[model samples]
Target: MAFGTVARASKRFQAFDLLATLVVVIRHDGTIVFANSALEDALGTSRRTLEGAALGNFFVDAGTLRTAIDGARTNDFATLRYEAQLRRGTQEPLPVQVTLAQTDRKAELLLEMSPQEQQVRQDREVRLLDQAQANKELIRNLAHEIKNPLGGIRGAAQLLQMEIESRDLIEYTQVIIHEADRLQSLVDRLLAPHRRPHVVGDVNIHEVCERVRSVLLAEFPHDLEVERDFDPSIPEFRGDREQLIQATLNIAHNAAQALAERRAAGDARITFRTRIARQVILNKQWWRLALELHVIDNGPGVPDSIKDRIFYPLVSGREGGTGLGLTLAQTFVQQHHGVIECDSVPGRTDFTILIPLP
Candidate 1:
């Protein structure tokens, strides 16, 4: 029955295409019979090509995978797991937790590959987004507390400055009023993300990218490169156009600032890349499809000293930086049920934003 159906099978493989995990079906002799889209992407090959290929040939520790397959074939274990590095055609070997399972067919097996730390970080992103909501409320309450007293303090200081006789005394009152006004401004910025109304509509991500690109280029105008490497097949998704624009702009603006030296030397470059991600998980929910935008730069990367805490309020890497750009960007993306993550080294930095599609 199985052999008869092979010509017309794959009615159920459609569901596996939507799974985040990479899966491949193996024949008893270790030849791959079927591979899902995720597996095809991980291997960077076509399904037709991967079929009938030796499954063990794609791993650095290929022997272990072959052994697991042999064990599964003999019913030694229903599922055997071993850590192996899956070798991509042109990329580095990927660390994955490999699982081998016996299928209903006597010689058939299923192999699953789950990327190691990437999944852990994604899980933590969900947790952080959960914390993001709490932080949002805290920011709102803190802003209101500071805002209510600011007006009174500034008014009192202004009145005292007028009544003071000594010039030094007037100067002291002026400082008081000036400091109060600064704090008020900070409070206003802290409250901006929460108070802004989300104007939802059909938002073309490329349009947002172009808008930000134009603004950034106009500001710098020379000595820097801003490139677009977009996948045109990424369909339009629902989102707030203005908020996404701000999010992208905030990240790109920071990159431009960090690239000041390189910009002056005519070596700075920032690239905007867009792709469609399948089977993405966000904020404890699963999404079959998502929009991915990468803001990459060739500046000195985020400093290691504060790389982990860069998203926290008032944490600034640059002098005189308000440190609110990334914070606000994260908040805006989180509001749209998306996430933003940063990966940085000395010469390369990537700020990636993921938004789920319906």
Candidate 2:
């Protein structure tokens, strides 16, 4: 009867192993006695290999593993935060956060990760929030100071044109009216995205990207190329459709402009890639899943002097640029509780957007 009871207990342990998130039971001597399915999947190793292996063998850094193990031994339950680089057969090292805990009978450690690919996502969100507030103030002041006077100037030019009888004089007045109208349109474009209503619903990210791509192709036609690499498995997320379209379009337009400048030099390219990342921490809160979209370009890259302030209102890199495109893009993405970040070097520039999924 005792042997039968032991056999039943072992079967129950095996059942629990298959269902848990991650469970690794280690002996007091620091050898792995049992590992669960989750643990095996995370480490990309089989149970047989892990059964007798030392717990520290999996950690990227020996010192961190020793410190965590020592802490767990002294305290009944202990947790240590450290990054472990996991080596899977031929794949690159995967960074993960290892949390070790101990009880009187067994010690268990939880391994999770915030992949480097998703780094700076939360920081981008905070920066976007700040940018949006700054833009609101900027638009209000600019509209009053600049946009209001634009109408008067255009009207004055019309009145002047009527009084001046000479053909040359009238032509000069016409130029003034045309220039004023151009500035008015620029300001309108800057404000249009902001005036859009907040329509919240399920948003298909690919649809947004496709819309941006079609618009960009129409605008640039022969000179530029826009490519897309999307993951159909990504589910619908919550956001405003028009706002996301404008936000993505702004970045793509900037890329097209940058590539145009490099067209005379060599072949230019812009790629839009999307994937899904898990276990991300955005705005100091953990998210189980987040959409990762990257707008990459091969151009001269953003000037270092203006790189840091590119998101600031009225900051522009191109001639005649209002510098509001990126500012508005940042604003709209932040409204969706997402982030947009840029990394530029000589030959490569990437604008990454991270939006949380429902």
Question: In order, what lDDT does every prediction score?
Answer: 0.86, 0.75
Q: Provide the RMSD of all predictions against the true structure, rounded to 1 decimal.
A: 3.4, 5.7
User: TM-score per candidate, in order?
Assistant: 0.83, 0.70
Which candidate leads in TM-score? 1
Instruction: Point out the worst 10-residue segment of candidate 2 by lDDT.
Output: 109-118
RMSD of 2: 5.7
Encode model 2's per-residue lDDT on 198-272: one tens digit a residue. Answer: 899889999898999999889877777788899999999878998889888999899888887666554767888
Query: Can you list the residue pairs that collide in candidate 1?
Result: none
* Backbone N/Cα/C clashes per model: 0, 0
What are the runs in model 2 whose C-alpha is more than 4 Å off? 1-28, 31-42, 46-53, 75-128, 131-193
Model 1, 213: alpha-carbon shift in Å? 2.6
In model 2, which residue pairs have backbone atoms overlapping below 3 Å?
Answer: none
